[model samples]
Target: MAHHPITHGRAGLNRRTILATGLLGTMAGFTHRPAAASETPPFRYEVTRSDTEWKARLTPAEYRILREGGTELPASSPLWQEDRDGTYCCRGCDLLIYSAAWKVSVPKGWAFFRHSERDAVLTGIDGPVPSYGMSPDDDTTMIEAHCRRCGSHLGHVLLVEGSVLHCINGTSLRFTPA
Candidate 1:
């Protein structure tokens, strides 16, 4: 057989060329992963300013948590040790959620209960996730809350075992202290 190379410099492609192309695509994906994965843009919770005006309605701790996105220290919430008769309402908008008869202690300072009263509170939806504990766990529920009129992020809710749910402080709600 005779070789015909008069018209071209190269005869055929090689394995290295194909491997290099694939490697370049993989590199591109790796470079962009972090930028996409860690970016959570900020969102507005409510239209009105509920913090300053409502200071008098909450204790110092509730004001810090509900107005500043602060978390109450474990075993420090008044609700953890409270034994009273009243409903818990948002200090910001006074939207009621829990009745005094429903509070339960689970070693976490905040209180847990079965559910919220209809028309007394609103829940925002959380979508599906891929990893362990990425979404709310079987004992936890996640929801964005707001006054029906104000759209505030009152706090997050986590459903617990035996149908109990915890409404943690989220820098936008307060109890009436009664």
Candidate 2:
């Protein structure tokens, strides 16, 4: 008896070859591609300042969080313990962003708020930015909240327990008693 190779019809492709080609094509379709740059212009804020002016106006920690988009260590800011009736303002421009009524206590250690004052913040998708305490290889995306007036980095908007949480960095805010 003669042994014969099993082949699919006209192309003479074997079962193993067809399966491997199909898997390779499927994997190629799933490969990650960086998003294309938007054609629209960048947003212009109500207040603008030079880098030198911003550095001079803000403290080292405040500058890091507000200008450089850096995150403070969890529970490191005194604002986390602030429970007084007051308003939270942007450390960069002193613009009121969050009201005391919107504040909520959460286990995340950051100053969590149910929401910001209307039109106080501008939110956009943060795509794996390493300056925001994410690793360079991290692919996680987050909703970044910025002060609408000064365009300073305030914090991130996250969903927690079916609620929208404005998880702000305390250093990015200045609390004023009402």
**TM-score leader:** 2
Worst 10 residues of 1 by lDDT: 6-15
Per-residue lDDT for 70-116 in model 2, tens only? 99999999888788999999988889899988899887779999989
TM-score of 1: 0.49
lDDT of 1 at 82: 65
Q: What is the TM-score of each candidate against the true structure?
A: 0.49, 0.69
Q: How accurate is candidate 1 locally (lDDT)?
A: 0.55
CA lDDT for candidate 2: 0.83
lDDT of 2 at 28: 56
- Candidate 2, residue 160: Cα displacement in angstroms equals 1.8
Window of ten residues with lowest summed lDDT in model 2: 1-10
Q: RMSD of each candidate?
A: 15.5, 14.3
